[model samples]
Target: MKKLPLKIVLLFTVLFASSNLFAQDFQGKAYYVSKTTMDMDEWGGRDMSPERKKQMMERMKSFLEKEYVLTFSQVESIYKEDEKLEAPGAGRGFRMGGSMTGGPKYKNVKTKEVIQDQEFFGKQFLIKDELKTIEWKMGTETKLIGQYTAFKATATVPVDRFDWRSMRRSNSDDEKKEKKKADKDSVKSTNTDITKSDDPLSEIEVPKTIDVVAWYTPQIPVNQGPDNYWGLPGLILEVNADRTTILCTKIVLNPSDKETIEQPKKGEVVTQAEYTEIITKKMQEMREMYGGRNRGRRGH
Candidate 1:
């Protein structure tokens, strides 16, 4: 009878070791589909003919819908857009006013660190910043996401936090003047000239705060999600923020091959606020340069 207790002790010891091994090698990959809705009226598209509006919407569709993959471990994760060939007639039209698209984003929950890759005006920038802690309000509701049950959580985040879809037009007088000048220039110039307008971001505005609703699954047992989202008790499966929605379609846990989660080291290292300021100054320089040229043309 005493030997029976010895056997029980040995069995528990084996189980404890196995659990630790699993924790050490634990990893997961999640696939997400992100979509954003743009309001045509907000961007002065209401006056356009139906054919012109259709063509514009078709071109913007590629930017509106995207797919991304998130590879995560217990403490670290990398979220990036999945590469796919551009649709027919979907030229790189969005890059005319400086590329706002960001590359892979790496986050470390344990250290509260974030590193993002950005390309602005043909220059690479590494935006390294401390992750802001999100205050999530957990709800009692639950829903099934694939095979796992997810719980609802909500939070409000400041709009200046690197969201491209949340951009709108500011109501400032300076912005109005810039818009008026651009409109006058476009009437005399080609579409290409209008696309490369000076101070393209002068009228752009982001709201004060954006509401976010996320659905997370505790079964995954990891606090991670797509884009600059982390926190909560489990892996987030879906996120709805402002005009964008990101939903996870597939999850692979502990696959045979593990991906290396490395921080992006390329580009000039700068904080989020510093990077924003840099873009602002660059846009101002472009505006001054173009304005001077226009005045000289009129003087002649």
Candidate 2:
């Protein structure tokens, strides 16, 4: 009995080692479609007529839906949006929400590095940041994602303040507080006509964190995924984060033409924190601008 147990252990160890050796030279591509839901009602769209709401939804559809291609190897991968021409004004939603969507992102699992190309308000920024680590709790629940068997894993990740998926419009209590503050500030101002500015971002609130669920396949045996998702024992096939869902539609392993994986080097280099600060300050300025405009209109 003891000898049989020892043999089984050895056999498992050998298989694991062989899989690692095979992964070292593996290259593949995964095609994914990402979609995020926007609740018009939550954003005070209930007051609009049904036809107007429908028109607004149609206009925002293209911005909330996208396709992406993830080309990956043993330790490195690049995820980029699949480019397609859109109708005029189809992408206006991108301006309202800060950049960091559908940009080319490169990740090196071995070095724990992430290099992303981001364009915000006509300025390009190269975000060189450490790969986000998720403490995934593995689950035994298994299902099939196409031909491969996928297993469930879940984690909770801190939400970025700029993450649109998890953002919600401020409630009545928040609005009241803001109004009170504006009233006080108006009293202090030399010009009694001036009130608080109408900040574009004031009504938006993002949670501190959100839960994520992913499905990964060990058959591919590469630690790569679409977007800023990785660190699993296998390649991630699907991810459900906040209001967004990313699903792999097709996969091609070891194609005839293998492209070299390269990091983006075109934008002004900045750390992730620095980029956040820049956007934050810009949002503040927008609030001031809107506030001044509102005051001017009221004066008239």
- Candidate 1 residue pairs in backbone clash: none
Question: Which parts of model 2 have CA positions greater than 4 angstroms off?
Answer: 1-23, 87-95, 98-102, 172-174, 177-197
Error of 1 at 209 (Å): 1.3
Candidate 2 at 228: error in angstroms? 0.9
lDDT of 1 by residue, 1-300 (tens): 345555345434534554454386699899999999987777888899989878887777777888999999999999998989876668455543336658999999999999999898789999999998899998757788888777789999887734668987675787667678776775566433323245445566778899999998766767898997889877899999999999999999898999999999999999999998998787667777775565555546
Candidate 1: where are CA atoms >4 Å away?
Answer: 1-22, 96-98, 171-202, 293-300
Highest TM-score, which number?
Answer: 2
Candidate 1 versus the native: TM-score? Answer: 0.80
Model 2 lowest lDDT segment of ten: 6-15
Q: Candidate 2, 34: how far from true, in Å?
A: 0.5
What is the number of backbone collisions in each predicted candidate, taken in the order shown? 0, 1
Q: What is the TM-score of each candidate against the true structure?
A: 0.80, 0.86
Candidate 1 least-lDDT 10 residues: 190-199
lDDT of each: 0.81, 0.83
Tens-digit lDDT string for candidate 2 (160-279): 898777888876886878878876776456573435435667667899988999998777778799998998878899999999999999999988898899999898999999999998
